[model samples]
Target: MGRYVRADGLDIWTEQVGTGPDVLLVGGLGDTVESWHFQLDGLADRYRLTAFDNRGAGRTAMPEDPVSIETMADDAAALLRALDIPSAHVAGFSGGSIISQELALRHPRLVRSLVLQSTWPVPDAYLRRWGLFIRWLAETAPAERTFLEGFYLDIYTPRAHNDGTVDRFIEDVLAFPHKQTTENLNRFLDAVLDHDTTNRLPDIDVPTLVLAGGRDSTSRPELGRAVADAIPGARFAVMEEEAHQPFQEIPDEWNARVDAFWRATQTRTT
Candidate 1:
């Protein structure tokens, strides 16, 4: 069953599966708990997997005020506290990874380990330009189809685009009627552009794993490397054939790597 927890004055929608050490999964910008559907059974057998919609996404209530990465991080921490979970292995994708970093930095004792996927410490000129383009598309596009087409172009590689996978994904996304509002999208984009955790990365003492997609044009592999390099003792790996959404593109490989990383950390701590 699913439930709601009050965090930062909003009702955050949350769900859990299986039973073991907790593994909190945070999805990317505009993503909901459904985005992690591919991961539930794969990891839940060995770990208690929890996934929640961020403040502005899915069933979570959005605050009228602007939100920051720090605020979102605090939401995650608060959710854990509400559930009586002392600490857990936290994994985040894209913008969610930024929040994961802040959660670890601000509440170090609550993060047992970290898995950052397709993440960057700060936005570069290329990323900033891409963000601007996305914003422009969101504002000026004539239809939702046009916007989604542009979005898919930016996120998926030729492997997905050439094989009709993009079409299926787009169809699925459009089927959701209560999509993110333009105001919330702008707020998220602003937060992502302003995110900078390079200086504080050295303070992250927990075991960390950074996964990158070599073919991802949106969040480049070099950006992932920068994150891994900044965090002391963080390991980095690249899935050459994937793009932004590796977990969806290749679930078995993605789940195996993450499961292995968590196991390694558990062994070390024990």
Candidate 2:
């Protein structure tokens, strides 16, 4: 448990383990730094891992009206600068991936390498439909099973979704601190949907690893392919039998691939 003051007047909650090249882990929407619990423990022995909650989630201060992806990217850059880390390997899952891409694009000097997982470049169709669902849930089903069911379908393996495992999943989400305000959630979701770096991806000089889940319905395989195709020399990998929560579903495989990717990139850079 550690706290770092960000440049944006927000006291960020962060935790670190091990000591090596910095590896910053950012979670998706409404997800706390605790969402990377498995990754933190898995990578702690080998790399310097930093996991933190974004604004409005976990212990971080929630700033209103100023929570765009650009601002979130700025927050990430500020976190690194505050740590005196000139550059670091950055990784994010789902919605967090947008912030990571923005950080790489807008604050290129602060990003050494990028790991994007279960993410897409924000397609218009997906945004229009899913964004509406988010708004509806926030307004009608705040903290209810309806929200969990829909979210699980979007973020979990089909097997998990079909297994009648709603209780535990809802419990896990309820464990986090969320406002369930449509405006707040929509503000973040819109920022994510509005962010598109496809045209600028080829210009990103940093090494990138694009990861996807074989069974992901939200950010499908095609999305991953598009991302890899856009970014020059970006490596793409899909976890077999996994979904949006691949890291949690298959920790061994996820860790092995992530560790290998980091080591290979580190060697190539050095």
Candidate 3:
């Protein structure tokens, strides 16, 4: 079952399942908890899985003001506290990775471990390129459509694209009611563009796992390694034949890695 509560003045919606250590799943920009449909079934039987929509997306409150990953991260902490969960394993994908990072950095006590996927330490060049793309996307429908089409190229292998999975992803995005405002999207893109966590990576004290898709262009496996290498004890892995959305592209393997990591961490803690 699911519950809705206003935490820190924002309407927060969440669903909890399973019976083990709490696992909070955070999705990327313009994504909802529904994004984890595949992974949920894969691991819920072994985890107290909690998935929710980020602010300004899905069923959560979308305030008039802009929101930052830091604020969103705090929201995450508040949700846990409200649920009486002292600590939990936090997992984030793509843009969600930024929230995960800030959560660990700003509210260390709430996060027992982390799973960061298809993410990177923000660099100025990355931000600049992203800004240009967002601006272009806002200006031209042709460009936006092109951008959406090209987005798959960055994340999936040629083989997966050929198999019609990538096509279905685009269809799903179109099917979802979620849509970001030019202002909200811009601010978010700016935050990501301005992000630079390289120096602070060493400060993360939790047991971390960094994952990347072999064919991902946005956050390549090499970048994934950089993140893993930055964390003192973080482990890094790559999903072969996969792209940006590893969990969606290869659900079985993605779930296996997540399941194994949580299981090992749980054993160690208990």
Predicted structure with the largest TM-score when compared to the true one: 1
Clashes of each: 0, 0, 2
Candidate 2 per-residue lDDT over residues 1-270, each given as its tens digit: 666666657788888887888899988877777778788888888889888878776677677656788898888888888878888899999889989988999999988899999878765586458767776776787456677776676777767666745456677767655443456567777778777877887878889999998887778888988888888899998886888888876777888888898999999989
Compare the candidates by lDDT and give the number of the best one.
1
**lDDT of candidate 3 vs native?**
0.80
lDDT of 3 by residue, 1-270 (tens): 556866888788787778877899988866777889897777877888888887776778678765677788888988888888899999999888888988999999999999999888874465367656755666564644465676556667787779988788777777677565556656666666667788998999999999988777677788888999999899999885678887887788888898889888887888
Off by over 4 Å in 3: 1-3, 124-128, 142-147
lDDT of 1 by residue, 123-152 (tens): 999998998888888899999888998887
Between candidates 1 and 2, the one scoring higher on lDDT is 1
TM-score of each model, in listed order? 0.97, 0.92, 0.91
> Which pairs, if any, clash in model 2?
none
Candidate 3 local lDDT, residue 248: 84
Evaluated at residue 241, the lDDT of candidate 3 is 64
Q: Least lDDT summed over 10 consecutive residues: which range in candidate 1?
A: 1-10
Query: Which pairs of residues have clashing backbones in candidate 1?
Result: none
